[model samples]
Target: MKFDSVIMGGGLAGLVAGISLQQAGKSTAIVSMGQNSLHFFSGSFESMTEPPQRVADLFKDAGIGLHYRQGVRLMPLGTFRESAMSLEDIELFPSEKFARRVLIVNFQGYHDFFSSFLAEGLEKKGMRCRIRLINIPDIDPTHQGPGEMRSVQIARTMDRIWEKVVQEIRLLLKDEDAVILPQVFGLQDISVPGRIRQALPAKVVFVGTMPPSVPGVRTQMLLKKRYQLLGGTYLMGDEAIKAHVHEGVVHSVVTRNLDSHYLEASNFILATGGLFSKGLVSNPFQLYEPVFGLDVEFAEDRNTWYNPAFKEDQPYMGYGVKADDTLHAIIDGKPLENLYAIGSILGATHPELGSGAGLAINSALVAVDQILSEK
Candidate 1:
C-alpha cells in the first residue's frame, strides 16, 4: 500500500508524525521494529531551560543557539504559545512549570506517587491528565508473572530495557499527557519496520519497544488497546534493518522480525531517536545511521561525546546528527530536501538545559509547516 508519508520508527517523534499526518488527511504509516522507547519514561516531556554548566559550554563550543528557561507551557502541535511555538501545523510546546514542579515516580529507584496519585493531582487542578506507560514486557517475552524480575530478564539481556522506557515516553507525548520524563540514558533512532504495508484495513498495529517494565505492565496493556482503537500500525519484536534510500529519499524499510520483510511508503520521517534510541547509532564504537545509510554527524571523538566517567551524569551524552537552521538533513556540506529530521537526531544541542525534545518539537513544527505550505 502507498502512503503519502511513511514514518520510520514509532517512538514519540514517529507517533506524533503519524497522528499529525493522519489528522491532516494524509495517508501515513509508521514502520517500526524492536521495542519503542516510550515505555520507561516518566511521561513528562521537558524543553530544557537550563544546561548543567559543562553542557552549556559544550553547546557554546558547538556554536549552537539554545536558551535556558523555566519549563515552558505545553500545548498541542497547532496551538500558539508566547515564546516557544507558533501558529503552525500541530502547534505544541512542553511546559516547564508543569514538568518540573510535579511529583515524579521512579520505579527502579523509587520516587513518590504512582498513576493514581497523579490522577488525583490532575483532578485537583481541573486539568485532565493522561496516564500511559510502556516499559512493560509482553506475553512473547515473559513466561512468568509480574512478581518475577527474572521475567524481565529477557528484556534486560536483549537490550530491551531501554526500549521499554522509550515506549512510555512516546505514549505520553502523543496522548496529551502532563509531560514525558524518561530516566533512560538517551534516545535511539532505528529504522522504520517493514510492517506498515502489512497492516489490515480495519486494524492498527503499534510498533513499539516491548518487554516488561517495572510496575508498568497494566498501563502498557491499556495503551495497546487504545492505540488499536485509534487505527494505528506497528511493527514490534526485533530490530529494524537498513532503509531503502535513493538520492536522499527513503523509499522502503526492511526489518529483522522474520529474517526480513520489506515495507514501502512515500514520504518518511526519521524519528528513530539518537544514539541511545538506536534510531541513529549502530555500534558502540559510535557508528551512526542504522537505517537507510543516512549520514550521522557525530563528535570527532567518542570521548568528546560523553564524560570519561558514567557517574558524571553529564548531559553532553545527548549528541548526534547535525542540521542547519532549516532542520534539513545535512551531510558533506549539502542539505537533503524531501528529508526532514527531528528530535534526538539533531546534534545542534545537548539535553544539558533539557531542550532536546523541545527543540525537536520546534524543528518538527517548522518542518511540518513547510510541508503543509508546500502542499
Candidate 2:
C-alpha cells in the first residue's frame, strides 16, 4: 500500500501526526504495535513551558473539550503541580489554593485509590476533607477481590451503576466545596463530572485511577475516532519489523502482520516511544532504535544513565534518537531527508514537570509541519 507518509507507532505522537497530515490533505497511515501511553495517562497535559496554542486547540476541536488553565493539576496522590492544560473534569485548580472543604468519594474496595494517601496531600494544602465510600456489586461480579478492579473495569460497568453512584454521592454531599471522585465515568463520558456537579452544589472533579483509566482510554479512543473521521488509515495491532531504507531515505516498511505486503510511503516517522515503551531499546552498554535503526543520542557511559536516588530525574529519560534542526532522524550521522522522528522516541525532552504530554504533542505538530513542507 502507498501513502503520503507512513508513521511507525500509534501512540499520541503518531495519532497527532496522522491527524494533522490528513487535515493537510496528505494520505497518512499509522502502524501501531499496541496500546499508546494514553492508557496510563495521568489526566493532565503537562509541560515545563507553556504549551503551543495548537495543542489546546487540537483537543478542543477534537471534541475532548480543552481548558487552557496553565495552573496546578491534581496528582494521583492529591498534590497539585502546574500543567499547561487538563481534562475538562479533572480535579484541578487555577492556582495552588484549593477548596478548603471537599468531599472525596471512594468506590468500596477500589485499590487504585488510597483515601488516606490522597488526604495527606490535601491536608498539606490545608484543606478539610471527608471520605465517602459507596459499594457497586457490578464491578466485581464473580465475588473476587475488588482490589484488582482497575479504572477501565469500573468504566465497563459504569453505565449500570451510574445512577446509583450519583444518588449515593448525593446523600453524602453536605457543606463541601468540591467532590473528588475516581475517574471511573463512562469510557467516553466527559459529562459525568458536570452532571454530578449539577446534582450537588459542590464542584465535581475526577482523579485518575490505575492504567487504562476511563479518562485516558476515553481520550485515546476519541482522538483515534477523530483520526478515522479525517480519513487516516490506522494499522492497529500491527508493528513495523523491517524498513526498506535505500541510501538516505526509507521507501517502505514491512510489518509483522503484513510481512509479505510492503507498506510504502514517500516519508516515514519513527515514534515508537522510548526504552520503557520499547521504541528505543538497549543492549549491553548501547541503545538502539528498534525500527530503522536510526542513530540515537545518549550518555557514553551507562553509569550516568540513572541517578542513584530513585526520586531524582534519571538521565535515561532524556536519551533518544538523534535528530537535526528539522526533527529529521539521523542515520549513520547523516539526516534522513524523508524520515522524521518525534515524541518520546525522539527523547531528550527532559521535561521540568508532569508526563511531558505537551512535549509529545508539540513534537508531533512540528513533525507534521516538516512532512507537509517537503517536495
- Alpha-carbon RMSD, each predicted model: 15.5, 2.4
Q: How well does candidate 2 score on lDDT at residue 64?
A: 88
TM-score list, all predictions: 0.52, 0.93
Assess candidate 2 and give its lDDT: 0.79
Error of 1 at 114 (Å): 13
- Model 1 lDDT tens row, 98-213: 32222222233212214445445444545454544443444222443334333133323323344454444444453342342221211211111112112211111121122333
Q: Tens digit of lDDT per residue, candidate 2, span 259-370? A: 7899999989888988867999997789998778888888889898899999888888888888887788898999987988888887763332224676678788778888
Report backbone clashes per prediction: 78, 0
Error of 1 at 14 (Å): 0.8
lDDT of each: 0.45, 0.79
In candidate 2, list every pair of residues with a backbone clash: none
| Deviation of model 1 at 115, angstroms | 17
Cα-based lDDT at residue 43, candidate 1: 28
Candidate 1 regions with alpha-carbon error over 4 angstroms: 48-230, 238-240, 257-262, 282-286, 309-316, 347-356
On TM-score, the candidate that comes out on top is 2
